[model samples]
Target: MKQPWIHNAKTDWWFILSPPFLVLLIIFVFQKQIQGLENHYSFYTWLFLIVFVDVAHVYSTLFKTYFVKAEVQRRKLLYLGMPVISWCLGIALFQFGALTFWSVLALIAVFHFIRQQYGFMRIYARFEPDNWSKKIDEVAIYTATVFPMLYWFKTPRAFTWFVNNEFDWLKNLPDYIGVITVLYILIVTVWIIKTIVEIIKTKTVNIPKTALITGTYLSWYFGIIYY
Candidate 1:
């Protein structure tokens, strides 16, 4: 029997088109005011950074595949170090007042690396079959999507639109929305940690997977705690 989550060709096409559709929806909804936001980075720069990162990600995935087969630890090191290195680079860029668009893109890249590492671990765990690891992987995927969106929404410039516009839909919302949102995030975070501990107990020394998960945890923990 086919997997419940797997889709056929036509369904896949719809799934592929959904993101662009949603983006257009967002743009259309905010069209009147979105133009006012400062966007200094040119389209060429955006395209170049996207292509560069895509190449890097493809190379990393290939390297990971080889390392997993050879039982090498070097890929683990790269997996763990990438987010920390990206975070440091992001901070340096911010300090230098480099291109805001590129800085944000770099931060997103760091997030993508973390997501990929966690996803790799999840796929590996499936090869070996561990419920706890699977659960933790699910949590990581959810947080990877949620946290980045939250961060983007909280960015000073991004938040300005909400502050300046009196949209009837959001105008009467509670002033403590941020606090409430954070509390919910914290609760989910605690759940993720608990699931991770369960995973550790089940597979204590799956080195590559361990390194990936540990790196992801450290990246998010330190990224938030210290920054």
Candidate 2:
């Protein structure tokens, strides 16, 4: 029988991935206070945030794509054309405006991050048959990942996705965002309570799923707040 907290060797979630990510989160949170880092901090952030995680996550697909000959053959057109199409789209967006380019890219990155959590949840729940559990997992992860983004849009922070006042357009939208933010917090609280109750009833846990949710919550919350 599969244990609730861990999988066998073939399915272990590689707990090793969490520590370095948490370290990165800590570094990101305190970046501005580091005196000598004023000029070079962006470089390190780009290295860790962009190169290490962002770019590495993209290439991580190699395991499911190019490495599997049959899968490659199945998605041959997608594999062959996505790069070229993405390149063209990128140039077009940049030409439209650098702000347009970066904003769209940042939005896409958020979508990727959200989907990655869903994917991990699916993997961790592969043996689970309870749809309610899956649904709650989705809601919790989405709340954790997306609330920070809502916070960012409503309250500007030290970091920005684009330059040259490109996002100034958003400032004039409305004032009811405060209400929405409160509702968001309430919903997140409810989800947490629901999850805890379910865990008590089941008397078991999915360790990897729990880790992903916690990491997403911590990272997104701190990343945006500190940004």
Candidate 3:
């Protein structure tokens, strides 16, 4: 049977598979250069990564949703009210304190990122039967992301989500981090072993799903842990 791709093979490959892998590839290729840019051209680097890329992603959402007539009509309340609701919520958060606002927003952004990754995985796997292998993929993907974030919450890190010390408001559990790390390792190993066995059994691989799962694992590992 032909592979069931959401937007056909090539488009899905470029959009989903290429991006995270490319990010890792680019960083590995330019690690020293990236460091130098952060050290010296810090402002420009922020502009490129956050302003050009991150904020641009927000703007790009319009083309896919708000700009589409059916999408807008399907969720008029969502499209219309969400912005105002978000604005009011932000104001409320800000009233708490600057750090509180940032901390809350940062955590929400992290949660969104985690959900978005899982969303793509679910979409790619929709054609497959819901079974043990599928469950492994789900758990593996979540662990790939949540493990790093749990590390972020439970331990001190050299990085920040948005601004400095944004995660300080989170509970710290340095003592349990080791145990969490072990659990993360076991899950990931099981995923790898099961994936290999599945491939051998079926004599095929789901490219989009496999790439997304592995890409997420590597991305979170390097972004949250290795960095």
- State each candidate's clash count: 0, 0, 0
Candidate 2 TM-score, C-alpha based: 0.74
Query: How many residue pairs clash in model 1?
Result: 0
Which candidate, 2 or 3, would have the higher lDDT against the true structure?
3
Compare candidates 1 and 2 on lDDT and give the better one. 2
Candidate 2 overall lDDT versus native: 0.71
lDDT by residue (tens digit), candidate 2, 21-70: 65656677676565356455877966886789768967898998989999
The TM-score of candidate 1 is 0.35
Better of 1 and 3 by lDDT: 3
Alpha carbon lDDT at 46, candidate 2:
67
Off by over 4 Å in 3: 64-74
TM-score rank, highest first?
Answer: 3, 2, 1
The best candidate in terms of lDDT: 3
1-227 per-residue lDDT for model 3 (tens digits) = 35658888899888778888898898999999988878898889878988998789899988999889999999999999999999999999899889889998888998899999999999989889999989999999999999989887766676676788887656653467888889999999999999999889999888888888999999999988888
TM-score of each: 0.35, 0.74, 0.89
